[model samples]
Target: MKRAWSPGAVYVEFSSDPRDWPSVGVALLVLVGMGAALVLSFLVFDERRFGCMSGIEIGKTLVQVALRQLAQLASKNDEQLHREREELALQWSAELKAAVPQAVAYLESRVDDLDARIAELSSDPQLRRVYTNFNFEAHREAIDERRRMLAHAAAGLINPEITVERKARVERTLRALDPADILMLHGANLVPGRMRGESLLGTPSGGDDNPGRMRADLLLGTPSGDVLASSGCVRMQVSGGGAGQGVWTEVFITQLGLDVLTALRTYTQNRKLSFVVPGREYKETDRTEEAARKILAALPGLGDLVSWSTRRSSQVERLYDRPRPTRGFAVLRFRMCQWQDWKLRLENLIPIYDKAEVNLVVSAEVQARSRDAKREVFVAQFNGPHDLLRYPADDCEALWT
Candidate 1:
């Protein structure tokens, strides 16, 4: 018998001579025993046992590959998250940098204004004493910055009569009240004596008046007085002959109220917008012409079909002192010949009017006999920001109740 070897298998050749017969039989028996042993190993162990790597070795190799892949995936995710975070940080930083210049400019301008005002007031010894004696930090804690600035400006520049204690009280009250409530005090300050509470705070008295018109609730939840009355800026007095008699109420601005009104007016008038009409009485024709010019400027290129006229405020009838009209406002009424044209103009003008910030009371009204026959009017009046018109008791009650 001869044997030879290759890379994958072993080969054996047996001679056909009688002398090699015994050796061939021994070799055949040996090969059969080896095959039976291989079958027994397969039945006893897993199939992976016979592979290039054993069962345990193959499992270890697969686990190492899986771990390597998992580590690579986690690293990629971490890298992506880091890049996203960096991008957002850069974006916010750019926005903050862009806004910085405008903010700095505004602050510098305000500082310059205060410096000039202080320099002007520093000349007076009495004003110096008032400032030196004032508890600025305590007052600052009591009021917001905007109101504190106005109060200080008024006390220093406009009204020398405002005592330090009065300043403190006024600032506190101004902080407590809203712009509308302050305007209410201004309306009260216009009159000398006590006026009917309903005159300014209630609904208008007329056959076509809307008694159900919604009114905002006073911050001070009391039923009898407005926010001004609640804040001690105005005194509300109710009088009755007896329990069975009809009761009437009157309101008057207090000294504290006057200070608040003065401070607001002084500050606001100084910073009034360009288009706003100054708060002063105008002759009938002058008022009409000025209001017409303002309306035309805001809505340019209007044809002759749109006509405008100025009329005395209806409130003058009730608000004025007897015999002569002491104080009143003008209402500018615009009439359009065609209702469709009026609506189109009104819709286009509403946003424009608001954007202009003209500080005028703007409204639209429709006068119609039928849907087919109608007239539209766009009205603009300088009545401050609040409705100064006096209304009936029932209408006034309808607001809060």
Candidate 2:
């Protein structure tokens, strides 16, 4: 079926809807024209629109380039900073190394100065004396402590139940000990042997005659007028008596003897064993007859009595006329009268007897001039028989005159 086409009406065609095709062709043509116009418009406005966007793109590119350059610059600056830090650290280390030897030298110099000062102090005499005193005090203290320990041990060994062999051993130990070690054992003060007159006898005497025996007389103070206790051996006797009448004390002077004597003396002094008499007890007795003979014998008028005959002549002299006296009885009477007058004169010139006494004194002093000096001083007095003196007789003339 075909339909006719009208301007405003519907038309039908039989050739497969030919009327619809013309309308379709017109719509296509209209669409084709619109597409051509759209293409043309795009071609014209594209350049102008893109030109506006070109500036924004270029700006973005420039910004990216700047950012890259800044990053490179920042990397270089970090490297420079690291290098400077390393250099500074090295400079500080070098300075510290350079100062080390100088600092060491300065410390060494200070130490040397201190050493010199110590040496100087050591050489000073006063300081040396002080050190010596300190050492002596320390040594003394140690000795005292040792003495105490030894005493305690000795006390333990002194038990009654102990064996005789052990007792002997302990006794031997004590005997072998030094004197100074046991000085304070008995709690008795003792004087040093050096301080005593132990060295007064220069050489030791020899022979069986004991010199220390004479010291006993000095120690005991036995009254015997003619006895002389001297260091050397010189025989002397009393004028009127035999050798037996004079009490002689022999001494053998030796170092060991002297030391023993000193110890004895110290012991005796501490014990107060010497005999003492009151001053009033000492009296002068009349012995003019006996003293006269001695005075007459010592007179210058008597020549040296070297021989027995000379000594006899000095005692008695005879006055005889060249011509034998006609009367022997008259000569005898004259001699008797002369003898009596001489005896009276001799008695007036001499003292017959003497009174002797012993004196003792003890003193102590501290030297004011010394610095840190010991304040204690020990002194003792021991007098002998020779120290006695005769009382002057009222009738007698002075011997010197």
Give the per-residue lDDT of model 1 (tens digit) for 231-256.
88767555444746555454555787
Per-candidate local distance difference test? 0.43, 0.32
Off by over 4 Å in 1: 1-158, 191-226, 242-245, 268-401
- Candidate 2, after superposition: displacement of residue 49 in Å? 18
Estimate candidate 2's alpha-carbon lDDT, on a 0 to 1 scale. Answer: 0.32
Reference-based lDDT, residue 243, model 1: 46
* CA lDDT, candidate 1, residue 333: 35
TM-scores, all candidates, are 0.29, 0.16
Model 2 Cα displacement at 193 (Å)?
61
Give, for candidate 2, the lowest lDDT window spanning 10 residues: 392-401
